[model samples]
Target: MRILVLSDLHANVTALDAVLEAAQGRWEQSVCLGDVVGYGPDPNEVTARLRKLGTQTIRGNHDKAVAGVMPTDDFNPVAKAAVDWTRAQLTPEHLSWLAALPPGPLATDGIVLVHGAFQDEDEYVFTPAQALDGLLDSTAEVTFFGHTHHQGGFSYQDSRLEVLQIHPRPTESFAALRIEAPRRYLLNPGSIGQPRDGDPRAAFAIADLDHQTVEFWRVSYDISSVQERMRQARLPEPLVQRLMLGR
Candidate 1:
C-alpha cells in the first residue's frame, strides 16, 4: 500500500490543501507525524480536516503545548504567542482531540512514526550524531520523524551513516529514492504548514511500501493568503515573514 507521510502541519490549511491536491489518488493510507495545529491561522480548521481524513497521527511539541500536555516555557516568544492564539481558536472538541493524541514512537506495519527522536518524543534529531544515536538504538528499519522541518534524514548501513537531502528543482514535484534492505533510515518529510528547508514550498513524502521506494514531494501554496490571515489575527511579524522565507 502507498502511504502518505505528513508531518509538522502547523495549521496552514492552504499548504495542506495544495499537498492533498497534488497527491490526490496517489496514497491509500495517510499517517501524520503531528503538529496538526499551532503557528498558523487555521488551527481548528486544520485539526478538523485531519480528523475528517482519519489521519493516524502522533503528538508534536506544538500540539502538546496547545493541548496543555506540555508547558510553553521552552517555546520562543513568537511560538508562545502563536500557541496562545491557537489555544483560543480551538473548540472544545478539537482541543480534546488534540489533547488525546498519542505520543510516539508509534509502530505500525513494521514502520515507526515519531515526532522527534525514538528515545524521546520531545527531542530534536537534527545532527548526524543525534540521528545515528537514534538509529543505533532503534530496532525498526525505517523511522519517519519530524521536528526540525528539514526535508532530509540519515541512513545507517554497516555502522556507516550518510546524510540525505532532496533539492528538487522548481518544476520537479518530487525526488524518489529506493528503500534498500540491510539499511536503516531516519526520514523527515519536512513540514506541510511550515517548512524550514530554505525552500518555501510545502514538503511531504509518499512511501510506496509495495515497491520499496520513498518519494519526497514539495508543493507550492498561497503563502500570501496565510500571511494575510496571520496578519489579521495579529500574530508576530517574524512568523509571517518566515513563511515567505521558508526559514
Candidate 2:
C-alpha cells in the first residue's frame, strides 16, 4: 500500500492543501504523525479536512495544549499566547476531536507511527543518536515519527546505524533497500506547516511499501497568505516571520 505520511501540520490549510494536491491520487492511506494545530492560521479548516480524510492522527504537544490536556504554562510565552488564541478559535466539536486523538507510538500492519520519540510521546528526537536510540527500542521495522520538522531516516546495518538525509526533490529517485522486515527504523516525514529546516516549503513523506522506499516530498504554497492571516489575527510576529524563511 502507498501511505502518505504527514506531521506537524500546525493548522496551515494552504500547506495541507498543497500536500494533498501533490499526492495526486497516489496514496491509498493518509497517516498523520500529529500536531494538527498550533502556530498557524486555519486550525479549524485543517482539522476538519483531516477528519473528513479519515486520517490516523496522533496527539501533538500543541494539540494537547489546545485540548487543555497540557498546561499553557508549559509552552513558551509566544507559544502560550498562540495556544490561547487557537483554543479560543476552535469550536467545541473541534476540541472534542483533538481531545479524542490518541498518543503514540502506534503500530499497524508492520509500521510504527509516533509523534515524538519511542520513549515518550512528547520527546523531540531530532539527532541521529536520538533516532537510533528510538529505533533500538521500537518493535516495527519501519518506524515513522514526526516532531523536529526535519526529514531524515536511520537504518541499522551490520550492527551499525546509518543515518540518511531525505532529499526533498521529488525528481531525485532513491533505490529501494532490502529491509529485514523485523528490524527497527526511525523516520521523520518533516513538518507541513512552519518548516524549520532552512526550507520554507511544505514537507511530507510517501511510503511505498511495495517498493520498499520512503520518498520525502516538499511542495511550495502561499506562505504570504498564512502570514497575512497571522498578522490579521494578531499572533506573534516572530512566529509569522519564521514561516517566510523556514528558520
Candidate 3:
C-alpha cells in the first residue's frame, strides 16, 4: 500500500493544496500526524479538506490548544496568538472534530503514526538522542512523527544511531530513501503549513510499504497569499513573516 504521510498542516490551504496536487496518483491512503489547525489562516478550510480526503489523523499540540483539550499557557507568544485566533475561526462542528482526534502512537500495518514522541504526544524529537529514545521505546519498525517541522529522520541499528537528512535542491521535488527492515527508524516528514528547516515550502512524505521505501516531498505554494490572509486576520507579525522565511 502507498500511504501519503502528512503532518503539522497548520491551516495553510494553499500549501496543503499544492502538496495534494504534487502527490496526485502517488498514494492510495493518507495519514496525517497532527496539528490540522493552528499558526495560519483557513483552519476550517484545511480541516474540511483533510476530512474530505478521508485522512486518518491525530491531534497535534496546536490542535489540542485550539480544541481546549490542552492549555495554551505553555505556547510561545506568537503561537499562543495564532491558537487564540484559530480557536475563534473554527466552527462548532470543526472544533468538535478537532477535539475528537485521537492521540498518537497509533499503529497500522507495522508502521506507527505520532504527532511527536511515542512516549509523549507533545515531545519534540529533534536531536539524535531523542530520536534514539523514541525508537527504543516504540515497538513498530518505523515511527513517523511530526512536531519539529524539520524534514528528516534517524535510524538505530547495532546500538548506533545515524541521522538521515534528505535536503532536496531548490528545483527538486522529493528525496527518496530505501527502508531496510529489522533496523528501527523514526521519521519526520516535516511540516505542511509551517516548515522550520529554512525551506519555505510545503513538506510531506510518501511511504510505499509494498516496496519498502519512503519519499520526502517539498512543494512551493502561494506564501504571499497566506501571509496576506494572516495580516487581514491580524495574526502575529512573526507568524506571517515565518511563512516566507520558513524558519
Candidate 4:
C-alpha cells in the first residue's frame, strides 16, 4: 500500500490542507510522526483535522507539552509562550486526545515511525553520527522520523552511512528515492506546518515500499493567511514570521 508520511504539523491548517490536496489520490493510508499542535494558530482546528483523517500518529515534544504529559522547563521562552497559548486554545477533548498519542518507534506496514530518535523521543537526529544509532538499530529497512523539521535523511549500507539529500526542487512536486534492500534507512519527511530546511514550501513524503520507492513532496500554501491568523491569536512574533521564512 502507498503510505502518506506527515510530521511536524504544528497547527498550520492551511499548509496541512495544501499538502492533503496535493497528496490526494496518491496515497492509500497515512501516518504522522507528530507535532500535531504548537508554534502556530489553529491548534484545535489542526487536531480536529487529524482526528477526522484518522492518521496513525505519534506524540511529538510539543504534543507532550501541550497535553501536559511533559513540562516546558526546557523550552525557550518563546516556545513556552506558544505552548501555553496552544494549551489555552485546545478543547478538553482535543487535549485528551493529544495526551493519549503514543510515543513512537511504532512499527507497521513494513516501516518504522518515530518522532525523534529511536532511543529518545525528544532527541534530534541531524547528523550522520546522530542518525547512526537509529539506522543500525531500527528493526525495519526504512525508518521515518521528525522533530528537526528538515526534509532529508540518512542511508546506510555495508557500514557506510551517507546522508540522503532528498527534497523536491522549487518547481517540482516531489523527488523520488529508490529504496534498496540490505540497506537500513532513517528518513525525515520534513515539517508540514513550519519547514526549516531552507524551503518555504510544506514538506511530506509518500512511501511505496513494496515498489522500493519513496517520494519526498513539497506543496505551497497561503503563508500570509496563516501568519495573519497567528497575529490575530497573539502568538509569538517569531513563530508568525518564521512560517514565511521556513526557518
Best candidate, lDDT: 4
lDDT, residue 243, model 2: 96
How do these models rank on lDDT, best leading? 4, 3, 1, 2
Tens digits of per-residue lDDT for model 3 on 75-189?
Answer: 9998998898998889999999999999998987668998988889999898897787678888788899999999999998889899998877899999998988878889999
Global lDDT of each model? 0.92, 0.85, 0.92, 0.95
Higher-ranked by TM-score: 1 or 2:
1
| Residue lDDT tens for model 2, 1-247 | 8888899999899999998998878788888988999999889999999999999889999999999988877689998888999999999999999988999978865588989888888888876777776788777779888888887778775578878766555454222334555455688888999898887889888887677777778888999999999999999999999998888
Question: What is the C-alpha local distance difference test score of candidate 4?
Answer: 0.95
**TM-scores for every candidate against the unseen true structure:** 0.98, 0.94, 0.98, 0.99
Q: Is candidate 1 or candidate 4 better by lDDT?
A: 4
161 Cα displacement, candidate 4 (Å) = 0.2
Candidate 4 TM-score, true structure as reference: 0.99
User: Mind giving the per-residue lDDT tens digits that candidate 4 earns over 1-247?
Assistant: 9999999999999999999999999999899999999998989988999899989999999999999999999999999999999999999999999999999999988999999999999999999989999998899999999999999999999879999999888999999999999888999999999999889999999999989999999999999999999999999899988888989
Error of 2 at 221 (Å): 0.4
RMSD of each: 0.9, 2.0, 0.9, 0.6
Count backbone clashes in candidate 3: 0
Q: Give the lDDT of residue 16 in candidate 4.
A: 96
Worst 10 residues of 1 by lDDT: 132-141
lDDT for position 196 in model 2: 86
